[model samples]
Target chain A: MATSRGGAIGPALVLHLAVLAIVVVSEIIGLIRVPIGIGAVILLPILYAFALGIIFNPNVLKATGRVLNHDATKLAGTMITIAIMPFIARFGTTVGPQIEKIIAAGPALILQELGNLGTILIAFPVAVFLLRMGREAIGASYSIDREPNLALIADKYGLNSPEGAGAMGVYATGTLIGTFVFALMPPLVHGLGIFDVRALAMSCGVGSGSMLAACTGGLVAAVPDQKDLILALAAASNILTYATGLYAGLFLALPLTEWLYRTCAPADRASTMH
Target chain B: MNNEIAISDAPAEGRAIDLASHAVQLLVVCAVALVGNWVATNVSPLEALPGMACLYAMTIVGLVIAKYMPFYLPSVAWISLVAIIATIPGVPGAAFVNEAVGKLNFLAMATPALAYAGLALTKNEFAIARKSGWKIVIVAICVMFGTYIGSVVIADLVLRITG
Candidate 1:
């Protein structure tokens, strides 16, 4: 009895209305700025909206939860990319004003993408040696394991495999809590007061939109006046991630992870290693 | 999983709606973002109406292009391309586009978009995370920090050297 209509104002419409309500409420709640460590952090309306969205989650309560239901919930999730189009457009518009700055960024914008390799370089060792995870570490620490990474892992290794589950672990956590975790980084780094704000902003481009948004939001919160430059750099770096992250993950990171897996996987986990 | 290479695995994009509803849904989100822009940025809704309208139009055109284009580029790419083309320095009406669109804070719009994303999170996604054990959580943090710090260090060194 599923209606299966995309644009129809069905149960999903209720979800839309709920989003509108969150927008109104979170905005009015405004930004809550607090001093933490060396720099300050402002809780953007998005944070409040995210918290409220959790409260309104179908699993947590039966209020709007009941109305959102399964179908409605699925639709809400899909709307994520479309919902952020305006922000993407904003990123686009801002880029034009400072195309020169982007050029001035030299090879850094593209080279920074190499930083994605850091995931396996660091996470792999932690997963293998410290956590003693199995073949799962191969998939888990390979990449950020977003949708594309998940697909790549699934293609190379079936979803039910240990590797697949490992990817899913990181992917699921990324979906559930990645935003908040990445959001906290900018200010903490800013507190150290080492990296230039522009460089830090560029690092906020971690591939995922919400994560990027939260990261850029955090950096701007840490360094306010440079909003323009921060966002433009973030968006540019993020786009490069979208463009190159998959190939890099597929050809480079995963292979490196496999070699590392062979070298460092626990005895029991390494027995049948690929 | 499908062959279509895009960001999220959630659902198909424009295939979900017709032209009219597509336009309507975009408008609705834009309207919500407008309210957010007013509240968070201290700009009146009236003052930013032109900017919202401008963004809305660009979004519509960009989506249309994404739909019709022969290739498989994502909607965001086309939308961003249109916006970038419109506002880039010597383009006609670039200033008007800049000033008008400037009225709306991009972050303001992102608040509502993420609110929708927040509402999108489901119980199943959470269950998967929990079943994975706490070890993965630490791994997730390490991965994120390593990625961020690694990039910051590289970009900082590159920028300083070039400067």
Candidate 2:
């Protein structure tokens, strides 16, 4: 199956087969726990599945990778949108029977979206003066640079420009590594004992479904009793993020980061380049 | 008339395969998901079949609705709406839909979902990620951290005042 040279099996089927095999292995491994000094970190099957995927990619091992083909990656991106439907429905279905519970989360659901803007507040300056990046920092720092933002940036800057390059750069990196950071973040923050588990769970909605899943999975592992509420709030929070991330990134985040870039990049460049 | 305004990045070759083939592919995924739910969550595949089928049906029907709708609302939203209304309190069979879907762990579904996503992470994309160097990489981490932390803080405050 690995070395078969394009007899008849389509790349999409091959990709699904790879997912099926990985899912079996990953689920058997199940969730793992590691005791770091601060706390025990829970690693979900999804994390293992993600790692196995990276290794399975043609880049690491030519044998399995050859079956993936060039079109497979593009196909993977499209399928991702479809693949998460049940996942969405999984939590989305929770909304009705649990409507009262979700309703109680209403205000926090709306307010937490403002927190997404914190992406630029923290990343813009770091990308500019500290990192000595150019205006590309604008696109990179404004929002989490997921699909909607990618379209927003591409619409404004056309993906061929520096700003667009910055956006795509972060978008790609997020796809590669964001799941790990998101998965691990909940436990670390939970360890801090500052944020409520429900709040931490709600905040896990970072726009991308995989990132949201990894984050919510970490929290569910951390606080299993609260799993139902966590899933409800995370799903609702994600929907709000999807509906608003574009508008907020366009009207608020993009413009703000553009100004920040203008104020800092020129001075930072002059001193550093000199 | 509406197809030409396509926003989807679906393979142009698969253009003809959109609605029908998509449902078939989803069925295959639902099967894999059924197995994962069995292995990981101990939810019997026998027990999970109805809920799995329900989610599958809701998704394909939702996609069809999204395709035909006059305006452009996200299919995720439509799918979620379909699932919600179908299971909402007092609707016929709502109880069955609720109990059935609730059996299959959402996180179990997430493993395969992310796995599908992970399959797309190409070596070329990884190389291109390095083209901009580590600055954007670090910045990306900060951005993710910032949004997550920021949301937690705000949510913590609101939930506290309200809880």
Any idea what lDDT model 1 has? 0.78
Report how far residue B37 has shifted in candidate 1, in Å.
Answer: 1.2
Evaluated at residue A180, the lDDT of candidate 1 is: 81
**Best lDDT among the predictions, by candidate number:** 2
User: For candidate 2, what is the TM-score?
Assistant: 0.90
For residues B1-163, write the lDDT of model 2, one tens digit per residue: 1211112352222223367656866777788899999998888999999999889988887788877777665677677778878877999989989888878988788777777677676555676587767777898999999999989989989999999
Q: Over the true interface residues, superposed, what is the Cα RMSD of model 1?
A: 3.0
| Full-model lDDT for every candidate | 0.78, 0.79
Q: What's the TM-score of each model vs. the native?
A: 0.91, 0.90
Candidate 2: tens digits of C-alpha lDDT, residues A121-224: 78887988688877688788888987778878878887767787788788888888898999898988898887888899889877788898889888888888
Model 2 spans with C-alpha error above 4 angstroms? A1-10, A71-74, A267-274, B1-17
Q: What tier of docking accuracy does candidate 1 attain?
A: medium
Kindly report which residue pairs in candidate 2 clash with one another: none
lDDT string for model 1 (A35-144, tens) is 86677665777778888888898877777766887777776765676678888888778877877898899588878788878887789889888887888888889888
